[model samples]
Target chain A: MALLEVTNLSITFGGLRAVDNFNLTMEKGELYGLIGPNGAGKTTVFNLLTGVYKADEGLIKLDGLDITGHRTAEIDRDGIARTFQNIRLFKDLPVIDNVKVGLHNQFNYSTAESMLHCGRYHKVEKEMDEEAMKLLGVFDLDKERDYLSANLPYGKQRKLEIARAMATKPKLLLLDEPAAGMNPNETAELMETIQLIRDKFDMTILLIEHDMKLVSGICEKLTVLNFGRILAHGDTKDVLANPEVIKAYIGE
Target chain B: MRKTQKKTLITYAIVIIAYIILEIFMKAGMMSSHLKGLLVPMVYYAIAAVALNLCVGILGELSLGHAGFMCVGAFSSAIVSQLLSGAIPDALRFILALIIGVVISALFGMLIGIPVLRLNGDYLAIVTLAFGEIIKNILNSIYLGVDSAGVHLSLKSQMALGLADDGKVLINGAMGITGTPQDSNFTIAIVVLLISLFIVQNMIDSRDGRAIMSIRDNRIASESVGINITKYKMTGFVVSAAIAGAAGVLFSHNIATMQATSQYFGYNVSIMILVYVVLGGIGNIRGSVIAACILYLLPELLRGLNKYRMLIYSIVLIVMMIINWSPALRDKRDKLRKKLMKGAGHGAA
Candidate 1:
């Protein structure tokens, strides 16, 4: 069975269909790319998948569990984690603390224990610190772990966000425009980090991007979307070469 | 030790050392009675300020109803101490009263938090403001007494209570509760303040504290990451209210009369606590302690200056705000610190 399966996912805003009859299936450990022109319902699809918005109609299944119309937190607990396009982070917190917040459910202690710093509180906190540092080390953020997240350089901030997402231990990860504002060098580094995340954490990733270099460099399967409909779907090389997909990118 | 732990330890040490110095002064008769009388009140207000900071600074919610929670604690503990007054030993009765006060306040926190926490920003603040006023009004009109016929309550005149001759009036409408045991002292107040600081500081360094702060930072991202928003918000708010209630207990026991008055539990008092949280530097627990102490004591200390007292107070408020917040000033201060440190390093070399 596939790690994620969606059938006929649809949503409408007023008279316009934001996402219409969108269907997707992904196997475990796949590096999938979702590409489209601006406002082709790509982020809307992400919102629906993560339960930010209830789908007008659809069946969303992850690891064979039907998770349609669940709340965002519930869907995350069911194993889909994502990064935002605008890079939402706990800016006042230290870098490692941001990831520890992501690991909230994994290590549990009662409110009383937390307030008093007794019982399992110390043990769990130490474990969380070690684990968060380990994840930060992967992104090369361990040294800057004590710095408030807002103070990090832009490229490092993006990496920290991805690190925070990985702390949740999700089965499938979603990256929304991972290289939205990066220089070529940073974009190249992000591409390597995306691949490293997949290889090291055994993560399955689906990312949306406008940067063709990063997209073509890493994505194995490609799906081109335009006007909320699939323009082309196939292996990366074949889909990129399709005249229909090319037309959608640079109109006829 | 971690940086946060070291900072927390320093806060504790400061409070303890101050307590010892004050005790020595009081015992040696070096402090005036008028000045000494303000001690417990000062500490309790500091405790309330700490609680408000947790709600406003850490949870990132603006609340103007904390005085209502404090009112709840004060009235409830007063009634308990009045009823239990001769039935138990003084110390034990006070402890029980404090416990009951805290529990009841926490329950009220949970109840009020359910509806108030749903609103955001100004709406939340407005609703809480209304809540504080409502609690004060309700408590003002209530007349409660205990007798062999169990407890008697009346919103009408105290006479409408129709208590038996032996019945003791716990609360007499607007007159409020009087003759309650005075069980609070400076030592107890300082102890409670330190404990409140410890709890809030520890919680901030824990997973739950991180969750609360994450919600404050980005609600949607926290939700996307599987953090339960309502649960965490409620947790921070209720704990904050509970701590305020503890402060209330200290307040009621420190005075001879416990009245639900606008002077004590009104919107202005709530705003005053917020000022402490803001002026102390939001999200800075130790700052709350120091701010509450200095700001609360300042007016009284300047009593000899009478007319100019408030003027100086307002000027100090403005100065503290700039020192804590103005970015240009902060940059300059940071540079000055670096320069001083560099000189010290050269001297050591």
Candidate 2:
């Protein structure tokens, strides 16, 4: 069985079909790419899958469980985590606290424990902080833990988002436009970070990126979307070689 | 683990020593009466201000009827304490009275928060303002004053629900409760203030507090996160309402002639409490406490201005807003603040 499945999923906003009849399937441990020209509904699929927008039509199942309408926090707890297309870090929070916010899902202390600073609270907080620091270390962001997320350089902010999402301990990680405003050097560094994190964390990743070079380099499987529909899907080379995707990009 | 635990233990030891010293000074006459008096309004208003902070700052919802909740707390405690002047132990009686006050106010909060928490902006302001008036009218309709029998007969009775002695307040209508016992003191007030501070601080730092901010920052984002915005908003509302209620009890019980005449728990009181939060730079707990002190003192400072005091205050508030919101000035202030904290943190380290 597929690890994640979307069947005929459609979402509309009062006459504007933001996403229509979207469908895909993913295997466990796959690193996949989703690509489209601007306004091609790539990000909308992410929104729908993450439960930001309700699907007006069709089904989304993650590991045999229907997640079409799970709450975003619930979705995160259920082994699925995603970064936003536009960076949505809790901009004012310290980088460590931003990651801690993700770890809020994993906390097991009571209010009483916190108030009295009980043994359980301290123990849980210590364990969680160490785990969060380990995640940050993977992204080479442990040094910047005290910095406010908004103050980070553009590339570091993207890394912070990934570091944050990883704190959720997701089984399937989704990164949206992770290399948006990077120079080649930063993008090249990001490529290694993403691959390293995938290997270290042992999680499947689905990414939507505009940079074709990054897409072609990292993705083993790919899906191409256009105007609310899937234009192509399958192995990265086949999806890229598909006539419809070629036509869509050529016409653009 | 070894180094950090040792450092934290030393830090905690210092904090405990400081706390003990402060408590000793407070209990002794080491602090001046003027400072003590100043702290009275500070603690009282802080209780109400934190509630306002929850509704106005954290939940990012507006309510102009906060004073009405305070009114509920004050009267509830006043009546209970007055009626029970001889029935219970000195300490336990007062505790019961305060509890009654908090519970009553929480009920009022739940009643108001259910409908009003959903309304945002000016619409919420109007609803809350009207709710305050309705409470005032209801209070006014049931008078409590000296009667022909020389017994205090208020429109409402001090009698516990069904306990008898319909001695009359709603058992007399708008004369208002007279001859009520005034038993609240600095000790009681400060203890309540500390509890209020503890609750407000805990809520602010907890996941629930973050959830409240999440609700304010982005409604859709918060809901998508399974935050149950309504529950968290109501939590802030009720907790704040209960604190305000406790303040009301303390106020009514503190002063013998605590009057709610004309505009007692009126719009101005609500605005005054809200100003405490806004002036402190919304969302800053320490800032709220400071704001309460300065704003409470502003009126006394205006005593020399006599009639012009309010005018000066109004101007000061407006000028403060101009200074605060100007991007360039705010950025400069942030830089200065960060520099100071860095210096302080380093020194502490």
Candidate 3:
């Protein structure tokens, strides 16, 4: 069974069809890329799959469980996690707390236990802190763990967002424009981080990017979206050479 | 101790010591009668402000109906104490009243929160403001009575209750509940305030508190990380309402008669509580308590200033706003904090 399956996903906002008849199937551990021009419904597809928006019509199955129209948090708990196009770290929170939030579901202690600092609360918190520290270390954020996330440099903020999302232990991770505002050097580093995360965690990744160089270097398979529909999709090199994909990127 | 733990310990010690010193002065007749009378009320308001801070500051949801929850607690506990008077010792009766108030208020919080929390920002503020007004109006016309036959409630007036001579009237329309046992004092208020502080502070440091704060900081990110938005929001709201209810119990029992007036439990009161939270520093539990105490006592302290009392109070508020929110001040404060942490690190080494 595919790690993720979406069939005929359609959504319209007002008069605009933000996404229409979108379909995707990903094998476990596959690294896929989704690319489209401005306002071509790339992020909309991510939103639909993550349950931030209910598709007007379609089916989404993850691990063979039909998960279309579930709550956003429920979709996440079902093993899908996503980062935003714009960095959305918990800005005022310490970097460690930002990652610990992703571990919220793993704690088994009751609210009462936590309030009184009894039993599982202490044990679970210690474990969570250790795990969070390890995650930060993987992202090269160990030294800045005590600083507020907003105080981090722009590149580090983007990295921290990914680190936080990964802390949820997702089976399928989605990145939306993770390299949007980075310099060329930062983008190269982020590309490396993305590949490393996939290899280290053994997780499937679906990325949306406008940076052709980063996508070309890392994405094995590519899906091109235009006007809320798939223009072409297949192996990255062949799909990028398609005439329709060329026109969609350049002009009419 | 960890830095945060040490700060928390010092805050508690300072509060306790101040309370002790104030009590000593009051007992020695060194404090004025008016100042002494303000103590219990100040503590009650401080507790309420702390409760509201959990909702407004930490949860990042503006709730203007806190006064309505406070009213639910106040009236419910007052009625219970009246009904159970003479049957139970005052101490046990007061404790039971407080528990009952907390439970009922929490239920109301859940009831109102489920639908109301669906809205955010200004819409939420408007809805809660309306809820507070509705609660105040309802309390004005409510008539409650207890007798050997059981309890009776009427919305029209006390005449509608039609209680027998042996029966007792608990709430008499706008006249409100009367003859409540004045069991609350400054010491009890202080203890309750401390408990409020403890619960709020502990909750902020807990796993659940992290989830709550995350929701406030970034709702979409929080959801993406699998934090159930509704469940956590309700948890914070209900706990906030319960604490407000406890404060209400303290308030209702501190006086012989309690009226359901806008001045006490209405839109204005809710806004006033929000002001305390904002002026204190959002999400700072200790700041909320100190702000509540100082702001509550300020008016009484300036009462001798006559007509200039309100004018001076407004100037103080404006000055506090500048100090608390100015960007320049914030930068300086942050720099100072960094220096302090560095100094502490050197000392430890």
Candidate 4:
């Protein structure tokens, strides 16, 4: 059985069919990729999956449980996490604190316990601080953990977004155009980082990327979307070499 | 151990010293009783402003109907205290009164939060404003008096039931809620303010608080992280309402009297609460309280200009806002932070 099963999910934005009959299913530990031209509704599918908008029609299942219309955070607690297409770190807060925000559900202490700094409070707080720092170190951001998130350079900000998502301890992670503005070397580094994160965490991943080279290299399976429809889906090599996908992209 | 530590200690010391001086002035004949009466309102208003800050500033919800919850607390506790004053032990009655007040306010807080919490930004504001008006209208219709064989149907009407005379309005219509035990004052006000501060501060710093902030900062990003944005936002709204309700208890008793709900519940009070948060810098709790006191107290000192006091106050406020919120001043402030920080380490290492 797949880790996530999405079928017939659709959304319309005022006569624009942003997502129509979108479907995806991925096995545990699989690294999958989504590719499309601009305005192909790649991000819209992601938005639907994350529950940012209610789907006009669809059935979504995670581990055999119906999760359609569930709120995003509830979906996250059900073991899916995603980095945004645009980096959305809590700008004014320190880096480690950003990761700590993801650890919201894990703490057992009450508000009273935290304020009083009582026995359980100190223990839980120390563990969270340590955990947040560990995630930061994984992204080579331990030294920069005290700086405000917005002060960090762009590449570091992207890394912090991934690190913050990892703090949620998800079983499946989604990356929305993780390589959008990166130069060649930074793109290569991010590809390597994503692989390391998946292996270390033993998590499944579904990512949307515009860079065919990076997506083809890392993903085992690939799905090509165009105009709210799946152009192709198969092993990455098979889908990448498809005549339809190339025609849709090259417009020849 | 560090400069921030030393500075914080000194700031606290100065505030305590100032408080001591104010107490002495009160003891001396220099300050009139009327002026001294302002103390409770000052403290209570500050509490309400800060509580509003938690909703509007930290949670980023525009809640206009705080006075509705405040009314529930004020009237509920007033009735309880008045009813039990003669029958219960003096010390117990006071404690019971406060507890009942807080509980009533919290219940209303939860109740109102359920509906209004779903509305966003301006919609939420409009709904809450309507809710406040509804509460005021309801309070006007409550007939607390009954006439017959010395039995009253309800607490508000029991006074009428107890009255053995003709033509006396017991808890009269729109005359105002009278006979509230005037037990709340400066000492209790201060204690409640500190408690409110401590609560709001910890909440914003906690994981749930961060969740609320995350939604405010980025709704889509927050949802993708698997946060129930609605739950978190509603939690913030309800907790903030509870604080407002508690402040209402403080406001109700300190006045020791009220004529109409309109006297306290109005559009200006909401704006005043918002003003405190904005002037102090939106997310800074301590700064907000300081701003509340400055805005509230500063006008009173200019007594000779009483006729145009509000006008002058408005002018000063407008000028201050242009200076403080002016992007030019903010840019300079950022530069100043970078300069000062270059001289020292960021935190306790």
TM-score, every prediction: 0.98, 0.84, 0.96, 0.88
In the range A1-252, model 2's lDDT, one tens digit per residue, is 899999999988889887878888999889999998889888889888888777898998999998878867678777788887777776656677677766766776664454345547668777777877887888888998878778999999899888877877787888999999889999999899889987887789999998889999999999888888888889999888888888898873
Docking class of 4: medium
Q: Tens digits of per-residue lDDT for model 4 on B1-349?
A: 5332354445345445656776889878778786677777777777777778888877787877777767777777776776776898866877786678777777776776777676655677887787778777766756454234443433355454465454223345566577777888677777777777767766766667777887777676666666677778877777777777777788777765564467686655666777877887676666666777778777886677889898988887887677568999889988997878776665633
Instruction: Please write out the lDDT profile of model 3 over residues B1-349, one tens digit for every residue.
Output: 5556676777788789989999899889999887888999888888999999999888998888889888999999998999899999999999999999999999988988898776655566677688778888888988889878888899887888888889999999899999999999998898988888877887887898999999899998898999988888989999999999999999899888789999899788998898888998888888888888888889889999999999999998888888789999988988998999899999999
Query: After superposing candidate 1, which stretches have Cα over 4 Å from the reference?
Result: B119-121, B334-349
How much is B167 displaced in model 1, in angstroms?
Answer: 0.4
Residue B349, candidate 3: alpha-carbon lDDT:
100
Candidate 2, residues B84-133: lDDT per residue as tens digits?
77887868887898899999999988988788676554566787788777
- In order, what lDDT does every prediction score? 0.92, 0.75, 0.90, 0.77
lDDT of 3 by residue, A87-149 (tens): 898988999999999988876789887566777877888899899999999999999988999
Lowest lDDT sum, 10 consecutive residues, model 1 chain A, at A225-234
* Top model number, lDDT: 1
Complex DockQ per candidate: 0.89, 0.25, 0.82, 0.57
- Model 3, residue A42: displacement in angstroms? 0.8
List the candidate 4 regions with Cα displacement exceeding 4 Å: A7-21, A54-59, A114-119, B1-17, B28-30, B89-91, B145-170, B330-349
Ranking by lDDT: 1, 3, 4, 2
Residue pairs in candidate 3 whose N, alpha carbon or C atoms collide under 3 angstroms: none
Best TM-score goes to which candidate?
1
i-RMSD values for every candidate model: 0.5, 3.2, 0.8, 2.0
Candidate 2 regions exceeding 4 Å error are A112-119, B1-39, B114-127, B142-173, B214-228, B257-262, B318-349
* DockQ of candidate 2 against the true complex: 0.25
